[model samples]
Target chain A: MTLDALIQRLRDFADARDWNPDHTPKNLVMALAGETGELTALFQWLTPDQSRQAMGDPHLRERVLDEIADVLLYLTRLADVLGVDLLAAANAKIDRNELRFPARQA
Target chain B: MTLDALIQRLRDFADARDWNPDHTPKNLVMALAGETGELTALFQWLTPDQSRQAMGDPHLRERVLDEIADVLLYLTRLADVLGVDLLAAANAKIDRNELRFPARQA
Candidate 1:
């Protein structure tokens, strides 16, 4: 499924579970951090190859994916609640960066 | 000032600039990346001390602080618009991380 579709599904899932209320910017940030930790757990000190091969277990893959999705979903919801056009803000920042870091140096 | 106060002031600044509408998740993400680049520019290949010393110039310090604030403001706006409680979310994420990366391992 498309990313947008997946996000929608995730949103719906949250809404259905009445979990949306707990998704304040503060809460989402915490949740995102938690999920990031989960993602990190998959590769604390493993070799690069071992980390890459983490998807070997279907169940484990699903679990990891779920945590990652949770992070993204909460972030998306955070953006929505704050009335942010993340894409536009991001592009503007890029322009600033180009000025700050010239291509020659980069 | 407190972080909350600073954030509130930032929101006011963005609102005054008519920039909030453009802060969609995508735009904010892009803006964040750009600001990150700016932050990175001050330290490319430089020693940590040199990077820290770059703040010697008051104007430069202001510029750097402004860029960093911009990144955070956009992110906060993104979260606000999306209804995410960033603090709560962050805390949740930390908890998840604790589970994923226990203290001994971390």
Candidate 2:
């Protein structure tokens, strides 16, 4: 599936739930942030090494993947509403970073 | 810049700071979660409408963007360490979602 397809699915999901009006950029961003927090909470008490091995637990991995999915869905929706192409934006961000923190120079 | 470039930059950033040892998948995920929390905190008390208008404040917008960059950076790094292609995984996820939440059926 392409990003376009994902965007369409999100639109359908929102339309089905009559959430279009509420799925504004700000709301979506907030939701994305919330989901991110949830994802983090899953590993809140783990040591760094423990966190590294988190996915070794099937249930924990499943939960982590679900939270990741939530974050991605909200992020894509927010970008779609704002007319931002996530892939392009991500690429552009990398370009900017190249200048700000030159790898060779660093 | 491509995703590969971004991944390289992340590698460089970690290498420059001697953070590679600490950049385990778990550590990266934890950092990502922490950043997400910070991002959500920015709009914690805001109503949905207020969240939508969040970027109208220049300072707030800047902070939001910074947090977003941080999240994306960490996400990409996490994916990299885990040998997952962020774009491909995202696409696969959408494909699965299409089956789970059929647009026309929904």
TM-score, predicted candidate 1 vs. hidden true structure: 0.43
RMSD of each: 15.5, 3.7
Alpha-carbon TM-score of each model against the true structure = 0.43, 0.72
Candidate topping TM-score: 2
Residue A92 local lDDT, model 2? 58
Deviation in Å, model 1, residue A101 alpha carbon: 24
Interface Cα RMSD of candidate 2: 3.6
Q: What is the C-alpha lDDT profile of model 1 across A4-99, one tens digit per residue?
A: 443455455556556656755444444544554564554455554444455566765555455444545555554454444434444455456546
TM-score of chain B of each: 0.70, 0.92
lDDT of 1 at A63: 54
Residues B1-106, model 2: lDDT tens digits:
4557778867767677676788876677778777777877777788777777777788986666666666777887876776556556566666676678665532
User: Which 10 consecutive residues of model 2 chain A have the lowest summed lDDT?
Assistant: A97-106
DockQ of predicted model 1: 0.03
Error of 1 at B11 (Å): 4.3
Residue B47 lDDT in candidate 1 = 53
